[model samples]
Target: MAATLPIIDLQELQQSSSSSGKLREACEHWGCFRLINHGVPVSLMSEMKKVVGELFDLPIPVKRRNVDVLSGSGYIALSSMNPLYEAFGLYDIGSTAAVHEFCDQLGASPHHRETILKYAEATHGVAMTVAAKMAESSGVLASDGAGLFEDWACQFRINKYHFRPETVGSAGVQIHTDSGFLTVLQEDETVGGLEVMDPSDSGYIPVDPVPGTFLMNLGDLATVWSNGKLRNVKHRVECKEAAVRISIATFMLGPPRYTVVEPPAAFVDGGRPRLYRPISYEEFRVMRQITDKQAGEALELLQGPAQPLSTKFDVNSLPADVLAQIQDID
Candidate 1:
């Protein structure tokens, strides 16, 4: 049976002990949830959304000026896959320099940059807190610094779904799970079309909007980081009516090449084997691009013990060609 999108309170998660169980359950089962009082200021969210709508309303030529440091990290326009959808992306939102570059590329004014930077800073704080709580919920101790992703590569994307009268009942964006560890999204409050897959893959359940809140979803990297324990939720957007829907998404992706991704020892044990081999985010990112399964397939292919953690072992053990290909992902 399908379930409503779980609701979590960020303040409660931090102040109460019971929140740990709730957080862990939502991650393990639903893989997605709605969060309230997550500490991203309501005023900032409003300003950010206004800026996003304005950003997408700009001339195509100006929008196209945005470039990608990593693949698909730039302005994406209407395509065959989803002609009604367009988006602008910014990579490594945590870094001051990256945010500045994104603003400059879009030719944003000083006010726009201020709003964007402030919103990014607030969202990142919420993301890190939620991520750490998830780990603690699963038995990871605070002393180990389990929930830190402050330096992780985060990508912020503003999505605009152009829903015209003729496009009602159409797929604005295809059904897919994010490739990152998790995504924090500010969904359109008055527009309701985002649907998450039912547990059995039998149908879809709409995630209606709640004001002053954001939604979070565990993704492929989260599943790998949790050793297959966490669910990688798949979702899509449909056009419910003729209305312009705008949303902002902050994706907290896996660690960079310098910090190889591996399931914590707590998630791996004799009874439950390691479901994935440790690989850099770059390697995983390239795999997803080549395979074209934005959700799960590439991560699955990197599974098994054949390729162990590159660290604490000799890299020469793997075939030279294979190693070279993985290195090229960076």
Candidate 2:
């Protein structure tokens, strides 16, 4: 049997300021909610859909040729075991011009690029609004002054799921939390397979897809930013025999390398001055990569007290040497 995911009407949010309380409750308890009747144009969405479909339909060899996991800026194709099911991803490179040129070279409509930029801008604003409300609900900052995340960055990712129907039972993705602060996902309405673990029920609950709506969830950075006041729920995607699932997600993240992530003073109880040392985002990302490569050893390091700041990789502000290293990775 399929379970229903909660849907929160955007109209309600626009109608009353009190709606934030409800939004906060839903986010806290469910860790996921759908926003309906949002302002994104339907025509724009259609164009995006068309472009994405066209891109995916390209020859597998052409697709593979473009895959660059190290670029962290382009396309990625992998068969890995994450919390979600198996998937292929195309990450935006923060350059509208570059994406437009790439699409144009592939004979994609130029209008699609324009529409994507517009959508990204609008969605970024919406994410900021929601984040502010969440901050208020978590008591980290005032509803109007939840500016701790003003320097956040936004990333757009398009993911497609491929399931081999003959394969008896396969999981799409393993259970895991997103790496950033928050994620707003727009999933294909026809197919269903996304599921979130219900902390209260200890069972998986399905999230139904709705047209013109986005599924919003908290991520690891939010938990860290709020000092664990807000939770980043674990969720996974299962492969369905009936249809393939595709989703467009935008991740809103914290500031660049130099920014420090520390708990708010309000979250500190029992006189625990500051639980985390001030670590730059650059340092954290490198440490994260190392941790991913060596999970067992990373766990051991976590068990010990804070060691001095040893290694930090500023990918965003790479020096000439670092740029060369990245080119090698790319």
Candidate 3:
């Protein structure tokens, strides 16, 4: 039988304990899941898609004006390494000024600009909610989860895959893990090519396009923040057919500027020492760039020194029942 990705309903996550368990399972094992009824209006999603298509349809010169506010954070032009992939980016979607700048650069009409802003705001709200739920699911946040994501930087990307029949079955983008904490993605409703690595058998499992639903992926930062309890899934896109594929992704990066990235106190106890040393997002980002460790190997370089076997236990490695027993004891 073919493998399937987990589908998590946002509504159920609040009202059902089993749903919360599923969220935890998805984070630990798959590192990604399909999110339904996530509160983003379907009409807004459709409007955003139409606007993205129109933006990408703009002439290369106009699109090029969407220059990088940060390295590789603006317009990613077509390249030989990934000829089928191109993207426009906004370094900070939470800022109204930043959104306006992106629109002006792309010569977006007022209506397009409004749609973009609305979509960004809606998605950002959803991202923060999901982040809180994730923290709650893992016991990182209990009563006070509201401020967990405050002031966190969010980057937005609009990806376009120029697929052709001749390119079918070829990679549209290389396999890699996301660099942030959590990613909220609006995938192309009519095209399917996304595949995530199945950690169990190391095989690729297709993530088919589901209209009106968002797909969420944990990233390298999530793994570190959770003290290695969360999995940062590896994924890729391929040319499935001779049709343009578009996706909008909003990434909630770790803490505010100049803030350190490390597991919260909840993740580190005598049983679970800090898995990664504290490092700022800028430092980590530069390290990834300098070493070209985009697939998450750079994280291993930051692993805390080995502790004596009797001093610590790998809670993530324990089976579900065993973990539950430990939690019960606590």
TM-scores for all candidates: the values are: 0.88, 0.77, 0.88
Model 1 per-residue lDDT tens digits across residues 102-172: 99999999999999989988888888888888888987666655445767878788888889999998887
Regions of candidate 1 where Cα sits further than 4 Å from its true position: 79-82, 305-330
State which candidate has the highest lDDT.
Answer: 3
Off by over 4 Å in 2: 1-4, 60-71, 78-107, 140-147, 269-275, 285-289, 293-304, 308-311, 314-330
Question: Residue 323's C-alpha lDDT in candidate 3?
Answer: 24
What's the C-alpha lDDT at position 312 in model 2? 53
For each candidate, the alpha-carbon lDDT, in order, equals: 0.78, 0.60, 0.80
Cα lDDT tens digits, model 2, 161-253, are 665665426666656666667787878778777788776775888776677778888766666665555666678777766465677777775
| lDDT, model 2, position 23 | 72
Estimate, for each residue in 149-212, the C-alpha lDDT of model 3 and write its tens digit: 8788888888888898899989886687887889999999999899999988989988888999
Task: Report the CA-based lDDT of candidate 1 relative to the real structure.
Answer: 0.78
Global fold similarity of model 1 (TM-score)? 0.88
Q: Give the TM-score of candidate 3.
A: 0.88
